[model samples]
Target: MTELQDTGLRRRADDAAPSITDLIDEETVQSIAQEAWSALVGEDEFLVPLPGDLPEDAVSSWVDVRGPWNGTVVITTGRSTAEQLSRELLKEHAPPVLDEEDIEDGLGELANVVGGNVKAVLPGPSALGLPVVGDAPVAGPDTCRVDLLWRGQSLTISVQGTAGALLDQ
Candidate 1:
């Protein structure tokens, strides 16, 4: 091969694959979560950035983003926290007793909004999948997570690469 071609190849090889840190930071993630919280969970509700112990019965909701960056935006919180959040989202419309489905749907929509905003900041032209609620996927190497507290309840938001580390382009 010509020396010019070899040099071009080397340059491409030197570029590292994009990780979560390369695209967004924890502060940015926290900001995105805060926006979602203020919009949906009530204008008065705010997410504190302090780290806290998550309850054993924590529940998670997430949405997948596929494109230059492939990962899931996951939101996790304790069961009672989730219920309170759902009620807050519904405001006076919430029933006297919140059911499991209500909690899941409310949290799922929160994930959708946060994930959509998160996707906008990432290397884009990406597609966002519907939100899923349950256990969160195990965090991978190229992951960005933010610990938060709402009403003094522990919650977390994680952006994890589904395909592990991104390989060189």
Candidate 2:
């Protein structure tokens, strides 16, 4: 191949993949935190990693993207935190009171709102699955976690929820 062609190939190789720092860079974290906090808790604060004591009843909502970029974004929070959110968000409803069903709904909405905001900045048109709630932290491959603390309550958001093909991507 000609020198010009070789140089072009080398440049492409150099820029072939996203760096680790670039993957979970400040911009991505800050932006997601901004959108999620504003939608859920009214504002965003200094977000830190998972604390020593993570609250129980933590729920996670995730969506799987199957195109150019593949992975999932899962939003998590304590059950109590979710309850507070239940009251806060449910105010828009007619009665403004939450029940067991409402808590599930609230969890979905929490995941949707947070995931939607994150999805907006992500690549494009990927299948965002329904939010999933459980007793433990959701784990996946190549995940970048953004745990949160709001009003003395702790919450978390897990990016990249595929154990097999997560970290590499």
Candidate 3:
């Protein structure tokens, strides 16, 4: 008869997953956003910490991270603000008539930059998914969200875990 002894390498199904707070905080997120804005949006653009209510027509863009920590980095702002950002991103190349595709592309790029930075602070060897624009994903229990204002416009960034894993909370 073969004897088996426990090596304690296995993890429980509900093993506590690492939270965003454990890896990074809102200040780091804001710093990353600021850098992205300065480089991509404009040289003088800055993000303020003052919180404001998001408009009913708010739009969001996000990128998913899969690794030791799994979640999404989402950026949300009003539609008009998105348009303004898109214009800034395109700068002199912006068309007179801003289009939906332009706004999404700009927002997606912002999310990618911020998401890539956020991923860097996490456990590492993580893969970032292509950006997606739409409603923000449902926040998990360990989600870490940050609110910011840009040119008096309300905007937010969130890092949220998987929905199924949220139930473990």
Candidate 4:
């Protein structure tokens, strides 16, 4: 191959970080969240594909995925909704009154479950990081986000590529 052609190929290879939109879609993300909610929260629970106003005090949980498509799978909702979700997730095992740690752990677990499933469908040989609770990482231009309502409360799930990764692309 000519030197110019080889240089072009190398540049293309170096700028090949995959976008989340290319790997997944809103419907797929909602389906994943629905399945997770049904299994973890309750079989009767449903996630309505309708957006509602998120309360001012919102909390976020996420898990980082490292691979050809590096990004985070994040879930954000109001604190009250998160607490309700925690109660539902714990069900019979939930304490009479949950503390902050319990709430965070529950949200984090949900993120982990959804993140694991998201990783499975992405390019092979990826690593999923442990769940985190707090403000979510900034999302880049290439993101697939699903907005839904669970029990009339707003919730969102986002598969977003890291800013740095997208910048490289």
Candidate 5:
């Protein structure tokens, strides 16, 4: 009879991919957003934990986080709300009439700030990608989403793993 060798390596389960839910929770995400808003938008600005209907012309800004768990942090709201946010972000520097570029830049900055904070809370040594503005990426099963209202306007924040990340696991 031959003795079997003891290999230290262990097999990983097929569903071993880390999910957003496992890394962070909705309340944490909301807190992060609230802090970002207070700093960028205004000290008195608040993000109410409530759901509202998103308008037809909804826009999104997002940043990708790459690390042990890869995913995107996205913020979505109506175009009008975005414009209002841009104005608030600009504050004293805001022009009477904001152009498209202004709106996009403001929204992108908000995403970058929120995404950076989210990245800090996750398992790191993670790299944060530059913010992108457009339609939001489709969220996967491994996601933590938060619905919020700012000034009674609908807004949402989602931390979701990419489809490729899920497939690679």
Candidate 6:
């Protein structure tokens, strides 16, 4: 695990995308189910120390953002949360319950939404890969993260770049 500052990702005057810190703060950092907070939590409250890591569970998803520089955005959830969310996401599709397959899709979709939005900020020339299931750690190169809290749960937003690029650019 490394901090972005250590990687020293400086933006040249000609660069279009903002620095990793700025990118995370302005784009990826957000409350999970913010719109539904009121309905679920009954007060539309934002989680404290919000913006935490989104851990991997039985069901989780992610999206990829690419451009002149390559990086990734990951979203994960706890296994229990996956089961609960799976019920909602697959109840109808499976006649009142979600199987492993349904949960997988839900996980992927969550990652996709978050990942896609982030990738859009970068130049269109790059490519973002599909989301996977596992507790992958993101901490290397130019990376920034926001820890989010929702009813005691944490959703981590990790952005890693400089993963592979100009070794000394």
lDDT of 1: 0.82
Whichever of 2 and 5 has more lDDT, that candidate is 5
* Tens digits of lDDT, candidate 2, 1-169: 0011233444243354543334443347556665665666555444455443565556655555554345566666766767777776655662555676667667667667666655554433555666655554345564566656667667666666433211222
Candidate 5 wrong stretches, greater than 4 Å: 1-19, 162-169
- Runs in model 2 with CA error above 4 Å? 1-15, 19-23, 43-52, 92-97, 136-139, 162-169
> For residues 113-145, could you state the per-residue lDDT of candidate 1 as single tens digits?
999998887654888999899987664554778
Runs of candidate 4 with Cα error greater than 4 angstroms are 1-19, 162-169
**Model 6 lDDT on a 0 to 1 scale:** 0.54
Candidate 5 pairs with clashing backbones: none
Pick by lDDT: 1 or 5, better one: 5
Instruction: Tell me which residue pairs clash in candidate 2.
Output: 61-131, 63-129, 141-162, 141-163, 142-167
lDDT of 4 by residue, 1-169 (tens): 0011233444356566655555577888888889999899999999999988889999999999887677889999999999999999999999999999999999999999999988887655788999999976675553778889999999999887754333331
Return the clash pairs for model 4, or none: none
Task: List the global CA lDDT of all models.
Answer: 0.82, 0.56, 0.82, 0.83, 0.84, 0.54
TM-score of each: 0.83, 0.67, 0.82, 0.83, 0.83, 0.61
Clashes in each model (backbone N, CA, C under 3 Å)?
A: 0, 5, 0, 0, 0, 20
TM-score of 1: 0.83
Worst 10 residues of 2 by lDDT: 1-10
- On residues 61-128, what C-alpha lDDT tens digit does candidate 6 reach at each position? 55556566566666556776655554554445545656767666666666665666565545335567
Summarize candidate 3's per-residue lDDT along 93-114 as a digit string, tens digits: 9999988999989999999999
lDDT for model 2: 0.56
The model with the greatest lDDT is 5
Residue-level lDDT for 102 in candidate 1: 98
